[model samples]
Target: MIGGVTAVAANGPAVNVSSVNVTPTDPTVGETVTVEVTISNQEGSNSIVDVSSIMLRTTSEHYERVEDVGAIAPGGSLTIPITTSFDSAGEKNLLAHVSAASQSNGSRTSHLRAYYRPITIDVEAPEIDAGIAASTNNSGETTVTLTNYGNVELTDAEIRTAVDGTQRDQRSTFDITPNESESVTFDTTNYDSDAVTLTGAYTARGERHEVTRTVDLNRQVQGEIRLTSVEVTERGTAISVDGEAANIGGTDVDSVLVRIPDSETVSPASGAGEFFVGSVDASEFATFELSSSVSNGTDTLPIELTYLVDNERITTTQTIDLSTASPVSPESSQDRPAATAGGDGSAGSSGLPLIPLIVGLLVVVGGSGLLYRLWNRE
Candidate 1:
């Protein structure tokens, strides 16, 4: 008891902090860290409780600060938990400190700083994403977009696109930051497929990552026009013609022109021989008129048709034969060709007009025979 005049009683109401414990000791940036501090009062006097302030601080490079704690009783201890996080990477020093005073004595003593295990923080790595989209117009093009959707920047990124398993285009971009995007285009007119895929690869923090995406094809408005029917009227040396055109393709056509092209055998009789058919909707038909003159021996004529598809002009030519039509005299009562159209059943005539000539010959022969007989009898 002589030596026990005693070490703890000699100093009195002394306050000190126990070792600190940090949870999730291995933490990445933006993650939470929990700090637990234990404050102890070593005094034996029950009436003289120790009042103390406990705080947590870092030596230099780190983010760890807790609210000061107060009021600890003699022969008692208190433990407090606080949450914190670090914004940067690397090692950080954590320290806990406590300052104390007692009612039995007015002296305040500062306890030695207690060090905890160092914290090593790791940063987030770069992430990349890719997606594909396809669109077809008259020119037939498909565009693929590669995006960096992650929170970090990537370097030396390469992107490749394919349609129906066939490689179409490939490109590379450098230092693509988060939210940045790049595009690659392929000619889909001849691609002949509805599915498209995009693949991208990049290097980040000495690691390589790859991403892929697939999309269906989207086609824009398109139009297709075709000649449906043609009718030819033989008016003396000139011919009056009417034709029907149909929109057989995907979209509607705004304007269509139908005409008989000038040749050695045929020429525009009255107008330019070209007529506008107006708008033709999908699966709809429009009519056009043309007047042309033909030479005595000419039997073939070319018909030219023009229309628009996706703002592009398309021209088509068709040949029709008129020799099969029966010859019609202006003196006869006939107005149109007696034969049916040949090519595509649209409008050219076939076969000769022998009915009118045969009738006239019979009447002339009967009349002539009667006159000759009467004259002989007289």
Candidate 2:
């Protein structure tokens, strides 16, 4: 055939990868790492097969493959972009191969030396803040807020409460992104303790992060003096007393002291105990309870109560006025005054207590976060 007039050629040509450039070089784990492969024909003029549909193998187990990229032309150029991310940090080797059946398959071959950098991500401990109660509700709650202060995303967080180290309520496994915070509640209605320690943690990306907190579930019934039944036979009358005390934080309090009010000066009716309930956790309501113990005569009496919560002493003065205990008074009577506290509700409240999830630990094995030197690329 060639002797007649012209000579024929066999294969087209081969391909060579030039420079591999990643726009935003250093990116955090779970973030998109765009891979741009610059390739061109090295030998003769042949149609290049878009072979972006490639695969990658890494030293760590925190990566995935996206899709096949298009082909590159001979002597010409083509940039195929691939988006990827990692769970752990380490080294990874990537490759791009063209199929033999494609136009530039048998003739072209390309390879890349990719170094997946090392990323340090730690799941920080859960942060907790507690205070005393503010309202008069016999039963109340405390609120505990859990914040994620890590550089990575967290999932499946769990929170639990304990009274004197006894598990009361628990919430399990929730999701949260970095810098975000969550709140959990615990009711101390039926619970009574001097102090309580709250311990919590969570699981994320197959690792566990743990954290604990200490709080004053301080409930010290020091004296025999207490407010008994005092009802409203009349219209303008109300009454209430302390409900329960629980540990809302992570630490335990041994003993709490309340001030002894002067009963002679402020009327025998005015003055009880002292207490402080900080950062209400579960049942954080303060509505007083009204009981009947009237002589059918309209009268008024004052009382004082005190307590220490979260290292703070609080004293409250309350008055129970029996104005209309007659027929009309019995028909129209007011309920108890409300109790106020820091948290929405965690413990020591009137309503039913609630639970929440707390996540904050990790596993440091062979190459998890310890080997920052061997895997990172400059």
Candidate 3:
């Protein structure tokens, strides 16, 4: 004791351990953590502390270290940061040790200062799988499936669809658990056998992931046929209908039969109301004729047509008016109506025979007048 003052020991290490900071103290498996070690020589009276090495040791399953840190001057501090990850879960211990040489009270000695920290790790991982369902077609209904394949739960799962490489529809589910799957449907009628894509998107553990699936779409064949330019004619009591039938669809039509269906005001002049026109190719036209005995005045004719497409008999009906046509008399004999030689021969005509009927009416009136005058004179 000098000057009657009791000697006081230095409160901190000559090379002081200032702080030990751990980043991401709460970690997940497969994630990184950072440990920062700060050391200082607080006393200028001591020589510069020669730091040989700095090592980071953890009680966790993995081990990592940092070495070859040369030295630190007196009254100066050094900070070292170490980065590492954990493979297992649970609590872990970390130690940062600095090996140094310094002069204390004029004597050279080796000193070690260590800092400690603890970490807790939680492990959670999420996986996703997506695909298009089998046999998805152009019937306007297509299915898409999304599966959660990992150990964690996912949220806000959405599935979107693309037809023929263009985005078309989307659907969503609120959440999905581990190893769980969900499905959604979309209308795909506007798409053909090109390509259909299904994309599944979701979030897990604050991170987002997505998966995609693609498949081919199969479409069905459709056919359309139409009849145009309908004309009706009459000869005596016989009636005939004429029109052009065309196949305007994607498929061919065969064994086509055209006819005027029988109604209360009309009956077939020959056998039945039907007449066959054979086959009509795609985008081609054929002429049809139907003969019947129809009463005068405005009459509705039900013209029914049928054909074979893919071994299916398809029938269609067309309605027409026969009021505009004039009936020709067989005995009154004007220019004769055109005769169509069917299995039963039938005829067609145009324009009325008005001149001969008017002449006959005049002659009858004049002969009546002459007879009347002679009887009066007698």
Candidate 4:
């Protein structure tokens, strides 16, 4: 009897890829990440499967690949790890693929492909934020501060300073970490400008950023000379004035001179025209004397002061009330003494009367002569 032959179908290897995971699911640009893909063999498979290749890829590009993976038993799973770095930042989809072959009769057959579920990865962009501030002190020293406010560290930081529009020779360069600050100081004593500008630049995440800050400089006079303790004394036809010059400003003054300018009512007194009080320091004083001849009907003494401040000449005028100095009247209470009553009940000057004293002198001389003649006759 001829029996009908029944053909048996062969069972191929089957693999199910699931659970696509990425270490550091939230990643920044240019940061490395690891992708783990779990590959499982179906329980109904007839033979052990050998994984040929495992690849981690996106929809448009492949990031990592590994070949020659070992065999996985039926109803068992194997995990494949791949490492890569993302060059850009944004939402990304990652898919993993596994190639497997069935091992039967000690031989491997054609590969079967399995794809893992795509995973969503959020890639963050690099953050860079910074600022700059500047300030100056009374001594003409300026300080600049650079602050990093973002997550990235700053590198190759440089600071440049300028007074008005003129750039300075001194430059500062350093590094600053995230959420930190750095400072630089410069001597701007020689620069007397009104404004100081600070420019700063730094590198973060392969990009350079620049910042600028401007500060107003307090332009104060280096030396301020003020007249103090002034006194006016009258000596015959000459008037002598003594005073102190106080320097109340920031620096010292040079070639300080006090003089009474020649005017209709006042003129310099001979050799004592100008008094020199040189080099008065800040918050210090120097004594000076000025002499002048004052005419009648003068009410104020116009005193002129000249000095050198920061190599520049400065002149100032001050006035002292002559009415308060000495009386202008001839019979002033301070100039003449009080009168007294004489023996004849008449008001006389301080001493005896001039004519009466002269007559008494003559009478005494005649008496002395008469006495001498009588002695000679005897």
lDDT of each candidate versus the true structure: 0.64, 0.44, 0.67, 0.78
Which lDDT value does model 2 have at 211? 67
The TM-score that candidate 2 achieves is: 0.32
Worst 10 residues of 3 by lDDT: 1-10
List residue ranges in candidate 2 displaced over 4 A: 1-139, 217-378
Candidate 1, residues 11-42, lDDT tens digits: the string is 54555564456665555455566767666766
Q: Assess the local accuracy of residue 258 in candidate 4 as a C-alpha lDDT between 0 and 100.
A: 88
Q: How accurate is candidate 2 locally (lDDT)?
A: 0.44
Question: By the TM-score metric, which is better: model 1 or model 4?
Answer: 1
**lDDT (C-alpha) at residue 94 in model 4:** 65
The C-alpha RMSD of each candidate to the native structure, in angstroms, is: 15.2, 36.2, 17.4, 16.6
lDDT of 3 by residue, 253-368 (tens): 89988887777777876765787878888778888777888676646777888988767889999887767666666665556665443333443243334556579999999999
Give one digit per residue, the lDDT tens place, for model 4 in 215-303. Answer: 77664547889899988877555677888999988878999988889988788988898988989998899998888998877778888
- The TM-score between candidate 4 and the true structure equals 0.41
Clash totals for all models, in order?
Answer: 5, 99, 0, 0
TM-score for each candidate, following the candidate numbering: 0.49, 0.32, 0.38, 0.41
Q: Candidate 4: minimum summed lDDT over ten consecutive residues — where?
A: 1-10
Report how far residue 153 has shifted in candidate 1, in Å: 3.5
Model 2 lDDT, residue 122, Cα: 29
| Residue clash pairs of candidate 3 | none
